[model samples]
Target: MQKTFSEKILAKYSGKSHVVPGEIVEVIPDIAMSHDNTAAISKTFAKIGVDKLYNPDIHLVVLDHCVPPANEAFAQNHKDIREFVKKHGIKKFYDINNGICHQVMAENGHCLPGTIMTGSDSHSTTYGAFGAFGTGVTRSETAVIMATGKIWFRVPETMRINITGEFQDGVYVKDLALGIIGKIRADGALYMAVEFTGPAAGKFTVSERMTLCNLAVEMGAKVGYVPPDEVIFNYLEGRAAAEYEPVYSDEGCNYDAVVDMNLSELEPVVACPHTVDNVKPVTEVAGETIEQVFVGTCNNSRLDDLAILAHVLKGRHIDSSTRLVVIPASSKVMIDAMRLGYIETIVSAGGTLATPGCGPCMGNHLGVPATGEKTISTANRNFKGRMGNRESEVFLASPHTCAVSAVTGKISDPREIPVDMALIFSELRKATLSPVLMTR
Candidate 1:
């Protein structure tokens, strides 16, 4: 019988000839990732009475959520994780300077095509950009994986989103993601694998594709995937650490649902203050004042994102009342942005640069908004109290929208701001072609 990508991959890893949705199968993931929360997982691992990891080579530990330690408690958590890594001799460890765990994994060659990876963070689905079967598990589940190197998965039904048409100016991949979430609501694809296909899928660069998968968890998807192609192969050329065989769904494969999205019909949109699914076109909420503008997160912090921010704020200053903060997704992305002068342009335009990590995305540290204040951010979620302060508000949008809002000090539409797409794309090309980004 024809099978979906999820069914085929799970079957291969589980050593089965064929498997279907809802079947539980045991398999060992190619990579298991954990971030700041690893400290807690380590404790649970120790409780399991396993003095050593089942396979150190399969584990990746990254300290990113509260880099440099937000306080005494957070510092202790980092310290515990470091000790755990050193004790276990985990070779794939990255310290706080590395950046977000998901970005670090992708850049360091851990997110290969046709492989299975699990992480403690929900956005672990970001690995699907490279066509990997990536998912997030509970902390206890992560601990179990660390101790045993084996995990069981119940295969999920597949949902296909076939996108068509080219993106309009100022309308971006982020808008598409938000539009989908708005239409389907938060629980739209709970415990299901969402596959992105159709002609437009090939047109998105690898970085753009990452955005598509990174937000999959926001809609309650178990995982997301985009079939690997030459674009993905080109990205993994020098970066991939292991040999991989790409996987694809069969032509006659069954799917739980099939949705079509027309890119030309989309406009710049934002997830409103309280929920990710409460999205509205930018024009509908224009003039809502903001106190802070954040342009970084695992979802939208990269060289391409920085280039867009710099392009929008070039030779212009932000609103004096608003604070603008920018953080690159990874150390490599940070270096490339610096070399391309994106950092200098942003800093000169009244933007504050923070250490490359998940700064302010979780409200753990760095640029948390004051109580009763409003922020326009590029993060995937905007639920109440998401940014540390229960009374503050966050509006989620694309980097383009965040940059424009920083200048206007309100929830403004990016299309209203004159941007030279040609110039922005030219700068991005320079950053993309840099050798620093090509390193594994």
Candidate 2:
């Protein structure tokens, strides 16, 4: 006789005050985000003749994507947008040197639990790390949210992912995410709200949680939510994020389905070339050589990640056959690492370091591999032509794995280099990682 938790949340978002998932309910969106990727979005929004953004204070304009813009012209391209944002009275623009769009908003606490939010970027779903429902919408849709605090949503069916067991050495959150993508496929979860359950997701950090939900859109998920808990509360308290009564579904709240998983023996993993869903344990794909190892991206370049690679490369040099590239997620991350001597270790070991920007990942600048060259990355996404070269082969792994691969030239696993990687791991475990970017 009673509705499930999913049914309740869906109904409220869909439109009705009563339990309804498909009602067109209006919520005063407390937060929203936009960035350079949508620089042209405004022009498109005007095509439909929308005069203003939903609510200026609730909008954040992040400039992380092409920051320190590659060329003088593109840099100017963003400059124009900066001027426009100012004209539009946008107050929360990150500009260059701030950080990634998703990273900044998530870190600063624009996201609150149990609210619906929207952004122009597909990865906007990353806000689910805090149990909020966020999704990527078209620029016009984003503009509509900008013009009106409310947007539309049809209550989506929910899917439960359950994981039990501990991850083995060298595997990190990315691998787990890729594993889920592999199981769900690119479109398997279309229009659904993905609620990660089970022990494994619970063991993840706020940063890791962001990484998991960030990729939800890749599977066509409408949103990705993790119920509130101590981790969520701890991350939000003392930060710029909104103060909300921590909300979560009761333990007895209904779920669409329960997924039980045991991840005890999970090994270092890779989401193979061409697809994020092509997952295979690193052990199964070992001996695969690579020509480059990249460390850093908005999705993976946290202090903890840098520390992990710093440990792996402490005394080891990059292999002659492999080139190592590291781009700090933002100026703060770069500056912080430099302040702590992590950057020194990374560079002294023959690792090539670049300023904070999305270079290699965009394939526009940086180490664009030659045809047939195998590359390993710590960043998210590995589609063909994604990294500047059309035929370059890419492999995705954790920072530890990326560093180890650089040391050995091939796709090396950090676990195999224990002597050189132990202290780093120990240090990483004790390091205090915080969000370096300003987010909603």
Candidate 3:
């Protein structure tokens, strides 16, 4: 029987001739990842009475959230994690300077194609960008994986999303992601795998593809995949840590639902104050004043994102009433942006650069908005208190929209800003060619 990508991958990992949706199978993960919360997971592992890991090689620990220790409690969490890593002799460990766990995993050659990875964080689905069958599990599940190197998964039905046409100027992948979420609502694809396909999906660069997969969890998807092709192969050329065989769905494979989207019909859109699915075209909410503009997060904080923000803000200053905060998703992204002068341009334009990590995206510290203040951010979610203060509001948009809104101190359409798309693309290409991105 023909099978969807998820079915095929799950079958391969589970040692089955074929698997169907809702069937549970046991499998060993290529990597089991956890971040700062590993402290909690470590405690659970200790309770299980496992003094050693089943396989230290398959475990990857990263310290990102609340890095540099926002306070004593956070500091203690990091301290406990370090002790756990050393005690278990886990070689695949990254400290506070590495960046977000997902980006660090990709840049370090861990998120390979045709593999299975589980993380303690929901956005583990980001690994699907490389054709990996990635998903998130609870802290208890992760602890169990650490002890036995095994986990069980119930195969999910697949949802297929097809795209056509090119993105219009001032519009981006973030807008497309928001538009899809708005149409489907938050629980539309609960516990299902989402496959993004078609001409437009094929055209996105690997980093852009990452953005598409990163937001999959926001729509309640168990995972999201962009079919592996030359773009993926080229990215893994020097970066893949292990050999991988790419996988694809069979023709006429079954899908629970198929959604068709036309890129040409999309415009600059934002997820308004309270929720990710509460989206509206920028024009519908123009002139809503903002106190802060954030241009970084795991979903949008990459070199390409910085190039767009820098290009738009070049030689222009942000509104005096609005504060701009920028954070690169990883140390590598931060270095590339600095080498390309994107950092200088943003700082000169009145944006403050924080340490390269989650920063204010999680509202843990760094750049949280004051009570009753409003912020336009590039983060994937805008739930109440998402940015730390329950009274502060967050409006989610693309980096282009956030940059433009910073200049106007209001929710504004990016098309109103005159920019040379060609120049921005050229700079981004230059950044991609850097040696830092080409190798581990």
**Top candidate when judged by lDDT against the true structure:** 1
lDDT of 1 by residue, 125-171 (tens): 99998999999988998889988999989999999999999889999
Once fitted onto the true fold, the runs of candidate 3 whose alpha carbons sit more than 4 angstroms away are 432-440
TM-score of every candidate: 0.97, 0.90, 0.97
Query: What is each predicted model's overall lDDT from 0 to 1?
Result: 0.89, 0.73, 0.89
- Model 1 ranges with Cα > 4 A deviation: 432-440
Give per-residue CA lDDT, model 3, range 258-279, as digits (tens). 9998999999999997989999
Measured by TM-score, how close is model 3 to the native structure?
A: 0.97
Show the lowest summed lDDT stretch of 10 residues, model 1: 431-440
Q: What lDDT score is found at residue 130 in candidate 3?
A: 86
Question: So what's the TM-score on candidate 1?
Answer: 0.97
How do these models rank on lDDT, best leading? 1, 3, 2
lDDT of 2 by residue, 1-440 (tens): 35544456555555554554444455556566777755676666667666776578877788866667778877876977787789788887787777777776766678778766678778888888888878877777666766666766666667777777876667777777777777778786887778887756776777777878887887778888777676777677787456674345556655555545456656678878988778787877777988888887766887767877777778778888888889877666676677667899999999898767676787867677888898889777888888888788888887777878888887766688753334544444444345422111
How many steric clashes between backbone atoms does each model show? 0, 23, 0
